[model samples]
Target: MMPMVLDWFIGNETCETIKTKSSDDVCQGDSTCYNVDNGSGYRCKCLDGYQGDPYLPNGCQDIDECKDPNLNKCEKICENTKGNYTCLCPKGYHGDGRTDGTGCVANQSGGSLIIELTVGLGIGITVLIAGSTWSYWAFKKWKLIKLKHKFFRQNGGLMLQQELSRRDSSTETAKIFSSEELETATNNYDESRIIGRGGYGTVYKGTLSDGRTVAIKKSQVVDESQIDQFINEVVVLSQINHRNVVKLLGCCLETEVPLLVYEFITNGTLFEHIHNKNKASSLTFETRLRIAAETAGVLSYLHSSASIPIIHRDVKSTNILLDDSYTAKVSDFGASRLVPLDQAGISTVVQGTLGYLDPEYLQTSQLTEKSDVYSFGVVLLELLTGQKALCFERLEEDRNLAMYFISALKEDRLVQILEKCVVDGAKIEMVEEIGSLARRCLRVKGEERPTMKEVAMELEGLRMMLEHHPWVNNDESRLEETEYLLGEASLKIGSNGGMNNVTYDSITDHIILQVGHGR
Candidate 1:
C-alpha cells in the first residue's frame, strides 16, 4: 500500500494558474512551489540543505549535510556548502575523492624517485636498489627474530619449557602458540571478534585454521619479574581436565601480554539466561538447578581432585558459561590461585567481585576454597531471584542481593522474592532446601561455610532425589520420602554421580521406611 502523504498547498488551482493570477505565493526563501498530483493544487519544497514546512516564514533553514555520514558519499574529506557538499582527498593522494568516482589513490612517489635515479645514474642503479631492498628486509627480519627472543625470555618461555619437560604425559599439555597463529585466528584482534570483556582482559571469538572455534583472551600487561608466577599458574590450570571446565588449549607469550586460548562455549552465559528478559522466560528452575550442580561440581574438582588445589578467586553468574546443550562450563580463571597441598589457606591480597566476595576473606586477605563457595552462593541467589549481584535500583539495604536474599529468607519471604519461573516450577520445600544451602554458603565467616565437596554433594543429592522420585504432594509422608531419598542420594552420589543406573535396592540399602497406611 502507498504511504500517506501530507501535501500542503495555497489553492486547489495548478502552480501555473496561481503564479499568473497572483503576485505572491506561500513559498518562502530558498523554496519553490510545484503542482501536486494529488487533490492539493501545489506544494512548496526547500531547494536543499533544509527541512520542515517550506511554505511558512523562515522554514527553509540550511542544514550541514556533511554532519551526517549518510547525507554524503565522500571517500576522503567532505566540506559542506550553503546548499551542497564537496569531497577532497588528503595530501599524497590523487582522485575525485567521491565514492561514486575513483575515490583516492596513493601518488606514485616511488616511480618518480626511480625515474630521477635512472636519468642521473646508470643501469647499475637498478641493481643497487634491488640489493639495498634485499638487505633492508634481511636486517628487519633479523631484528624481529631478536625481539621475539627478548619477549620470550621476558614472558618466561624458558620457565614454561622446564615445567613442560617435567611432565611425562604427552596427552596432558598446553600448546605454546605463535603470535601469528592467534592473530590470524582472531583476524588481527578485530573488534567484531570480541566475545566478552572484563577488568582482567578481553575475550575474542576465533576460528582456527583447522576449523575449530576457540575463545582467545588477550590479557593486560604484566610485570616482567612475575613471569614465573603466571607461567606456573598456566601449568597448573592446563593440568585441570574437567568436562564442566573450559579447557585451556594454549597460550601466546610473544606479545606484551600473554594470549590464552580456550574451547569456545556455544551458549553465552548463565547470567544471560538468568537475567536477560527473553532468555529468562524459557530458563526453567530444573535447568538452573542442573547448572548450579554442574558449577558446584567443577569447583569441588578444582579444590580437591586437581593435582594442586585451585581457589577460584572470582566467581559469579557471568563466569558460569553454558554449552550448546545448556550444560554449565565454569570459566574465567584469571583470578584463580593454586593452593599448596600442605596449607589450609593462603595469605594474599583480597580480590573478588563486590557482591560475591567472602566477608572474612575481604577483611583478613586470606584466600580459601570457601571464597568460591561464597561467590557461588551469590550466583545461586541470582538464579533464584533473577536479580543482579549488586543493584543500585533497589533500596540501600536491599541493594546487595546476597544480604537481601538472606534477609528475605529470614523473614520467610522466599516465595515472594524467587523468580516467577523458579517459584512456578519447584515445590516449596525443594526451593527452601536450596535456599538454606545458599545461606550456609554465604556465611560471613569463610570457615563457617561448608566445603565445596559437601556443597556439590548436597546439590547432587537434591538433583538425584528429583530424578528418582518425582513429587506428588506436600503431605507428611511425601516430605519424609523426599528427605529419605535425598539422604540416600547423599550416601550414593560418590558412586552413582547422578547417573541413571541407580537401582532401588542399592539406593535403599540401609534406610528403612514404612509404606502405605501401615505403621
Candidate 2:
C-alpha cells in the first residue's frame, strides 16, 4: 500500500508530501538518534563515557574519565584534562598504570626495603600483643587457683580429712565442700540468703545440687591462733549424732573465715517464739515444757554421753532452734570447750549471754558443766513467764528475769509472775515443781546447781506426769503440797538478793481481779 500523504497550506501555496526525513537517518560516529515512529520528532544520544547532544558540532566530546570509578582502570592514581584521561603510578611505584605496561611495581632498592621492613614490624607487633594478652589471662587463672589451694591447706583441710578417715565408715561423714559449690548454692553469698546474724557470723540459707536445703554459718572474724581449736571442734561436731543437736553436714574452708554447713531448720529460734508477741501466743504451756525438756536432754548428752565432755559455754534460748514439728535443735558451739576426763572445770575467758551467765563462772572465769546448767535454768524461766532473760523494759528491780523469778518464788508470788498461758494450761502443782527446780539451778555457786543430767530427768518426769495425768487439779492443797516438797534446801536464798515487798496474797488478789475483768 502507498504511504499516507499529508497536505499543508503556506501563505500563498499549497503542498502535498508522501515522505519525511528523521534525525535517525543522519546519526553517525559514536552518536545515535532514535525515530519517534509517530512522525512528530526524533532524539540524539552519545555513547557511554561521553556527554552532549549528538546533533551539534563537537557535541560528542570525550568525557573526563577520572571522575567516574567504572571508566578508570588506574592502579594507583588517575588524572584528567579537557578531553582525555591519564593513569599514573603513585610515588615509590616503578611502572605506568596502563593496559600495555605493568600496573604498579615496587622500587628495586631502598623503597622496596622500606616497605618490607614496615610490613614485618607490623606483623611482629600484632603477634606480640596477642601473646601478651594470652599470657596475662593464663597467669591470672593460675594465681587464683593457687590462692584457693593455699587457703584450703591453711584452714585445716588436711587435718579434717585425716580425722574423717579415722572414723567408722558406716557412720555419715562430714563433707568438705569447695568454695565454688557453696558460692553457687547461696547465689554467691547473696544478702537475701541470710537467715541469721550474731557476734560470731552470719548464717545463709542454701540449696545444694543434691536438692537438700542447708544453713551455712560463715564466721565474721578469723583468729589464726585458734585454728587448732576450730579444727578440733569440727572433728567433735562431726562425730556427734543426736536428734536434739543441729547436724553439721559439711564445711567450706577455702574462705578467709571458715564456714560450717548444717541441715536447715524451717522454724525460727526458741527466743523468737518466746519474745515475739505474735509467735508467743502459739507456744502453749505444753509446747514450752516439751522444748525445755528437749533442750535439757541435749545439754545432758553433751555433758555425759559424748565421747568427750563438751561444755556448751553459751546456752541461751536463741541458740536453740526448732523445726517445722517444733522439735529442738541446739546450735552455735563457737564458744564451746572440750574438757578432759580428769579435769573438773575449764578456766577460760567468761563468754556467755549476760542474763543467762552464771554469776560464779563470771566471777571466777571458770567454765564448767554446771555453768551450762545455770544457763538452761534461765531458759526454763523464759518458758514459764514468756519474758526475756534480761529486759530493760521492765522496772529496774525486775530487769533480770532470773533474779525476779527467785524473788517471786521466795515471796510466794510465782502465780502472779507466770505466763497467762502457763497458768491456764498447766496445773499449779506442776508449775510450782518446775519453779522450785529452776530456783535450785540458779544458785550462785556452780557446785550448788544440780547436774545437767539431774535437771533433764526432773523435766522429763514433769513432762511424763503432765501427759499421763492430764486431769490433775490445781487445788490450794496441792499448791501447799508442792511448796512443802520444794523444801528449805532447794529454796535457800543465794547471794543474788530477792524482792521483799511483793506478797503472794496481794498479787493473787490483783490477778484474780484481772482474770475477772477478762471473763
Candidate 3:
C-alpha cells in the first residue's frame, strides 16, 4: 500500500508501478523484475544457467548447455549439470582427464581422490547393470539348449541306433538326420510347410540345404500309454531294409513331440489316384496289375525276409505310394509288428483300417502275417473295380465293396461289378483266375489265404502274359480302335478267345519311351 501510494504521486494512472512491484516480489534465484519503460507493464529475466522470465508461473528452466557439441569433453559421452558440464570417461577407458587432459585439468595419482571417487562410482554402476543383463540372457539360452538335449536322449535315440545296427548295415539306405538340420529345412517346423495331417502326427515337406527333399512327420503329444508304442514303432521301422518299404531316414527327438523323417514320394498315394475321377480313368489294367504285384512283393518281403518277420498290421491303399514312373512303393510302417520267427503268431488287440481289417484277426485278437494279406486283397479289389472299400452312398447290401465283391464271386456275377477301365475282354479263365485268387485271399480263415509269395508270383505271371499279347483279354472294342490309332500291334485271339503272343515292341518303342501317366 505504501509503494502504491508513492507510485500514485509518480503518475500511476494505469497502475504499472503496482504491477511491477508485485512481479518483483515473486522473482527468485538469479532473477530480477523490471518495467519495460514503454508502459507495457513488467517482465522478469533469469541469470545464466536458467531460462525464461521468473515472474511468470513455470517460466524458469535449467539450461541444457551439454547438448552443444562444443561442450563434449569425452570422445562419445557427455553429461550436463545445473550450471556445469561433465568430462566423463568413455566406454573401455579409465582415469579422470589424466590420460588426454583435453578440456579438463589433470588429476595426479594420489591428489586425484575426489575425481577418482565419482568416476569409479559411475563406471562400476554401469558395468554391474550391463553384466547382470548379459548373464540373465546367456543363462536363458543355455537352459533351452540343455532342455533339447535332455529330450533327445529321453526319447530313445540310443535305443533306435541299437535297433538299426542289428540289421544288414550295407542294405540300409536311410541317413540319420539331426534335429537342427530338420528344423532349418522346415523353417523351424513352420505350419505352412505341412503337406498332410494324420491322427498320430503332421507330415511336412522339407527341402534341405543340399537340395534333398524329405517328408518330416512330427508326432502329436505322447501320452503315458502311447510312449512305449511310439518307441516300439521307431525301433521296428528303423531296422526294416526292404526296397518296397517306405524308407525311414531318421528321427528328431529334440522336440516335445518326436519327428520322423522319410524319403519323399512324389506322385502321391494309390488311394488318391484310385478314388479321384480323373486319376481313376487314367489308369490302365497293366498299371493296376503292376501296382498290385509290387505291393504284394513288399508285403512278402516284410513277412518272410526280415530278421524278425513283420506283419504290417495296417495295409491300406492310402499307405501305398507311387513313384514318378508309377511304380508302387509300399510305405507307412508305423503300425507294423515284429513277429519272432519261432512263434506261430502273436496275440494282440485288434488294430487296423476298418474295411481292410481281417475279421478273423479282429474277432480272435490274434494277429498273423495273413492279416496283412487280407487287407492287401481288399486293396486289390479296389484296384480291380475302382471303387471304395466302404461307400454308404450305395445300397445297404452293396455299401461294403469287399462284402459285395465276395458275394458277386459266389454268385458268379463278377462281370456285373467290374470297372469299365478293367473290362478289356479279359479271357474268362484269366478273369476267373484273378477273382478266385482274390476270394482265396479274403477267406474268413487266415490259413486259407495264399502266402504273399504265391500272390506276387501269380500277378507277375499275369503281367508277363498280358504284355506279350495286348489284345487277348480286352472286352471293349472302343479301346481296340484307340489302340489302333496309337499304332499298337494287334495280338491274335484263338477260337477259344484266349491270347497268343505276337511281336509288338517295334511299334510300342514310342509308347514305352513315353512317360508313365498312372501312379
Candidate 4:
C-alpha cells in the first residue's frame, strides 16, 4: 500500500533519518506504548490498579479487593473487576459501602430492617441470661455467709473466744474450727463417715488437713437455753489431761448445733466387748480387770484430780470406749455436770442410763460423786456376770442385774450366777473379793458407797493381787472341765447333807476335788 508521510524536520531529508518500531517490542499486554524521537525508541506504562510484570502475558491480572477488604476500604461488600474494584452495600444496608466514606446503614423500613432487629434482640437475650446466672450464684454465696455468721453468734462464739483469751498462753487449749473446714473434711457430712449415734448426737469420722483422725459429734438439736452449759463443758473437757479420758481436740460452732471433735478411739465400746458373744469369749479375766481398773482410775481423776470436779451423770458400759491396746477411754460427756469446789453435791434433775442409775440420786434428785460409784458398781456386775445391767429375757425377779447379783450374794449363790468365762479364768477368792467390792458400791444409800478414789484403789489392789498371786491349779483346760461339770451336776444336786447346792463354798470344794483327782 502507498503510505503518506509528513516531514517537519527542517527541509525533511525525505524523513529517511527516523527509525521504525513494532508495538510488541515496545510494551506489554496490560500497558500502553508511546514512541519518542520520531519512532526511534518507546516507553511502557501499566494501567491503573494493575501491577507485577505487565510486560508478560497473563502476569498483570485483576486486583481482587474482596481478598483484603481494607485494600478497597469497603464496609459491607467488595466486587473485583478486570483491573479495578468496587464497594457495595449488603442486603440490609444502604450507602456507598466504603469505610473511608459514608459506610453501609440500616435500611430502616422493610424486610432488611426486620433481619437487623432479630439479630440485635438475640444478642440482648444472651447478655441478659448470662447476667441473671451470675447474679443468682452471687446471691446464694452471700446468703450462705450470712447464715454461717448467725450460727456462730448464736452458739456463743464470742464468749468462747473470751474464755480462751483469759487462759495462759502455755496452757493447752482446744482449737476453734471453722464449719467449712469440717464440712470439707467430712465430705459434707457423708453418711459413710458416721461411726456412732446416740441420744445426744451422731459421730462422724474425719481426717483433718494435718492428717489427724478425729471423731466429730454433731448434736441432734440446738438449745439456746443450754449454750452457757455447753461452753462450760468445752472448758472443762479441755482442762482434762488424763490417759483414760478421751481428748477434746476442738469444736466447730459455725452450725446451728455445736460440733465437738475428739481423739478417735480405735476399738469399739466396752459394752460391745462385754456383751457381744463372739467378743466376750476373747476377753480374758486379766484384760477385763485391767479395763475395770483403768475405767475406775479415770472416774477418780474426773472426780478428784481434775481442776474442776466433773460428775459423769450418764455412766454405762456403752459410754466406755476401748483403744487398740484395750486402754479405757471414757467418752460421751453430753450429760456431764461440773461441780464447784465448795459444793458437796449438785442437786439437779436425775439424768442417767436406766440400769446404772443410782436409786438414792433418783429419789432425792441429788447428784454426787457417790452416784458415780453406784453406776460403776453396775458396770462391775456386768464384768463379773457378762449380763446386761437390765435384761427383759430374764425372770421378773432377775430382770435387774444389780438386784439379782445382790440377791445371789446374800443367798451365797455367787458361783452359780458368775459368768462361766469369768469363773473359768479367775480364782474363786479374787472373784469373791471383787463381788464384795461391787456389793459395797451398790449400797442403796449414797453415803455408804465408796468414793471413786477408794474404788479405783480397790480395783488396782485386786489387779495387783491377780498379777502376783499364783493360785493353785491354774490350768485353763482343768478350769474349763470344772466349769462344765459344775454347770451340769450342780443343778441336779440337792442342798441335802454336807454342802448347799451351787454355793461359792461348794464350787471351791468342787474345784479342789477336781484338782485332787487331776481331772
Candidate 5:
C-alpha cells in the first residue's frame, strides 16, 4: 500500500486509483497546511490581499494598513502609529479629516493686518473656484466645436458645398448656415423651440434674422461610411420645388448632423387632426377626404413629375404636414429614394417605417414606385378609419390595419370595422366605392396597385362628390340637392334592419351630434 501511494504521488498510478488509500492523508503545522502524497507534496502561503491560513485557529492577523503609505489616500499629512493613522492639513491650512481643510490659518491678532490677509485669501479662493469653473466650461465648449466639425465632415458638408457651387446659377441656391446663426434663431435650441421630433431628428421652430418662421430639421448622426448617402440626400432635396411638398429653405452644416430648414407649416402634421385626442373630433369626413386628395396629388407629383422619380419610402400621416387651413404639405424625405429613369428599380437594403413599409419591398428589397403606393395605402386606411396603421387591440395576424381592412372586405363587414365617426349612415354605394379604392391601393402585388396619378384622380373624385353632397342636419330638400349633386341619386346606404343610418337633417341634431358625419 505504501509503494502504491508512492507510485500515485509520483504519478506512476492514477489519482482515481489512489483515492481509497487510507494512509495517503498528510497535515502540516499550525501556521501552514499541506496535502501530501509521496513526492508531489505542495504548500500554500497565506493570502496577502486577505489574511490568515483559512484553516488555522483564529486565522491570521490583518496587516497594519497605516504602515503602508501606498494604500493611504491622505491629501495632506498622514501620521502613522500602529494599525491606524491621523490626517492633518498642511501648515498653511488647518483641518483634522483626510481630505478637508479648515479655512486658512485662524487669525491670532486683532490687528488690521490679519483682517486684510483674511479678506485677500477669501477673495483668492473665490477667484480660483470661479476660474476653474470657467475653464471647465471653456473646455467643454471647445470639445463640442471639435465634435461638431467631425460630424459635419462625416455628413459630407464639403460635398454638399461643392454640389451647390456647381449649380449655383440654374438651381435655387442652397444656404450653408452657421451654428451661431441657428443657435441664436432657436434661442440656444431651447425645448420651447422644438416643433417636432421623429426617427430622423428633432425639428425646431425658429424665426430667422430675416423674420421668416422656419422649421429646422436636425438630421441624426450618421456613420462616416454613410457620408455619400447624406450628400446624395442633400443634392436631391435641393432640387425639389413643389407647392404641395414642404420647401427646403436652407441648411446648417456646422453641427454634427446637418440641419435642414423648411417653410414652417403652422397647423402641424395631418396625423394630429386625424388621431390626436385633442384634435380628432374637429376633423370632418370631408376634410379627411380633401386632405387625402391633396396628399395623393403631392405623392403623384413626386412619383412622376419630379425631375427624377422620387419614391417617398415613408408615406405615413406624420410625414404629411398641414398649413393653417389644412392644406397638405408632403414632407420628410430622409428615407425617400430618387429612382433613376434608366433603372427599373433599385436593389437596396430595406428602409421605411414598419406600419407603412411595402410588403414587397420589405421581403425582396427591390424598391420601385409601387412601394410608395403601398405606403400611401396605409395613409388612405388611416384617413378612412381614423385609426393607426398598426394596433395591438386587433387580432394577432390582423394587427396591421391594411391586413385588417382586407379581411374586413373579404368578410363584407366593412361598416363594423370603420370607426363610429364614419359609420353614421354613409351611403352603401359611397362606402363601397371608398373601400374598393382602399383595397386596390392595398393590393399584395405592387403592380396590381393603381398608379399614383390614378389614386389622385380617384381621391379627387371622392372629394368632389363630398363637396357637392355635404352631410346635412335637417332639410330633406338639402339632402335631395346633395343626392342630385352626386350625379347618381339611386344609391342607398342602410340595410332594412330598422337601423336606418342617415345623415342628421336638423340644425338641433347637427349641434347635438357636432360635426357632419358622412362625406
Candidate 6:
C-alpha cells in the first residue's frame, strides 16, 4: 500500500548459491550476509563500529566512534579500529576505562575507599527517599488524627466520657468504637459493603476485628442541637436486653457523621419477606403472627420496662429485621425518643416513614408509645395483606394501605382483601382475630389504640391459643375473651419467652405481669 518494494537478491535465491559464482555479488568488508527467512533471497549487514552498503568492495567504512562520544564508553581515551574501538584509562587512574567493565578509579599507593564511598552514597540516597515518603504519610496521618479529634469534640465525645464515668460500671453497655476499626471492618465503607440505604442513613455489613459479623449504620449529619439525646441513645439501648431488639454493640463519633454498630441479622427485613413475591408466598400466617408478637414485645419493653420510657418514633416492617429463624428484632432507633416517666409522651419534630407514620403524631407532633403502635399496626397489615405501606398502583383514595384496610374492614371485605397466602395458611378465626387487633392498633386516636404492651400480650395470647388449647373448657366465652384479652387466670408465655399472669380486668394496663423472654 505504501508503494515500496522489499529489497532482496535479484534472483530471489539463497546467499550460498549466489556466493558460488565468486562475483562482486558477495558481501563487503565488515558486513555479514544471510538468507532471508522467506527465501526471497539473501541480505547483507555491517558489523559493530561500521556502517555502509555491503554491495561494493570496501563500501563498509569504520565508524569514528572516538568522534562520537555516545558510541564510545571510554573514561579517558578511545582508539577506533576497522570494526570497533578500544578504551584506555587516564594516567592517574587504574581499572578498565569502560564503565560497564571496571570504570576508572584513582590509582593510589594506599587502597582507595571506593567501596565505602559507594555504600555511603547508597545509604544516603535510601535514607533521603525513606525520609521523604515518611514525611508525606506522616502529615496525612497527623491530619487524620486532628480531624478525628475535632469530630469527637464536635459530637460531644468528652461529655459522653464524663457521663459514663459518673454512672457505675455496671450500667456501661455501649462501647465507643474508633473510626479506623469500622473502616477496616467495612473496607472503608466500600460500596460493596453497603446492605441498605434510605433517607435516614446507610447500613453496611461488616466483620469486626474480633470476627463478629455486624451491621454498621452510618447515619446522616447529627443535629448539634440534640447532641444530648444523641449520646443518650447509648444509655437507652444499653439498658435494653431484649432478644427481640437489635443489639447496639457500640457507636463511633470520630467521623463527621456518626456510626452505630449493631448485631447483624441474617434474614432481611419483614418488609422484604412480606412484599417480595417469592418470600411472601412462603411465609405462613403462623410465622407472621410470631414476628408481629416479637416486634411488639420489643416496643412494649422499651415503653413499659426500660428505666426510661422510650417511644420508637419510626416503626415499620422495614425497621423490623428477621434473624435466620425469622424471629423479629426491632431495630433502627434513629428517630426514637426517650420520654420522662412523668410525661406520657414527648413532643418532637415529626419524623418517620410515610404510609406508616401515625396521623395523630403527624398532626400534633406528639409522639407517644401509641405512635409506635400505629406504625406496628401498619406492619401487621402488611403481613396480612402482603402489600406495601404505600403504593400508587391502587386507586388514589386507596393508595395508603392503612386507609384502604380500614375501609375494607368497614365494608366487611376482610376475607376478600386478605393476602391469599395468609388466608390459606391460617385459620379463619385466627386471621380475623389478628385483623381485629390490627384495626384496634390503627385507631385514629392514640389513646384509643392499644399500648404496645397490650398488643404484645394479645398477640402472644393468640399465638398460644394456636399452639395449644384455649384456657376455657370449650366455653362460648372464648370468642368473648379473644375480643378483649385471653380468658381469666390464663398463664401465657411471652413472645420471647417469660410466663405472664394474664387476667381479664376492667383495664388491661393494670396487669403488672412480667412480659419477659424464656420458653
Query: Residue 39 of model 4: what lDDT?
Result: 39
For model 6, how does the per-residue alpha-carbon lDDT over 372-415 read when each residue is reduced to its tens digit? 99999999999899889999999999999999999998898888
Candidate 2, residue 328: the lDDT equals: 90
lDDT of 1 by residue, 8-56 (tens): 6557888888889889975888898888776768878998777767878
Q: Can you write out model 4's per-residue Cα lDDT over 296-380, one digit (the tens) per residue? A: 8888888888888999988889889999888889998878888999998988877788889999999999999999999999999
Write down the RMSD of candidate 3 (Cα, Å).
17.9
Q: After superposition, how far is residue 341 of candidate 5 from its true place, in Å?
A: 1.8
lDDT of 6 at 62: 85
The window of 10 residues in a row where model 4 has the poorest summed lDDT is 510-519
Clash pairs detected, candidate 1 = none
- Please give the lDDT score at residue 161 for candidate 3: 64
Which prediction has the highest TM-score against the true structure?
Answer: 4
* Residue 469 displacement in candidate 2 (angstroms): 0.2
Candidate 2 per-residue lDDT, tens place, 1-519, comes to: 899877332223111111132324344456765544434445557876678867676678879888787777777788885556778887677788875568878677686778889999999999999999999999998988888888888888888889889888897888999989999999999999999998778999999999999999998877777677778888888778888999988898887778999989999999999889899898888888889888988888889888889998899999999998899999988788898889999888778888999999999998899999999999999999988999999888989999899888889899999998899897676687788778888999988887887677667656654564341444544544543543432322112222111111111112110111010
- Reference-based lDDT, each prediction: 0.81, 0.79, 0.71, 0.79, 0.71, 0.80
TM for every model, in the order presented, reads 0.68, 0.68, 0.63, 0.69, 0.64, 0.67
Candidate 4 backbone collisions, by pair? none
Candidate 2, residue 502: lDDT: 13
- The pairs that clash in candidate 2 are none
The local lDDT score (0 to 100) that residue 127 gets in candidate 4 is 96
For each of the candidates, give the backbone clash count. 0, 0, 7, 0, 7, 3
Of 5 and 6, the candidate ranking higher by TM-score: 6
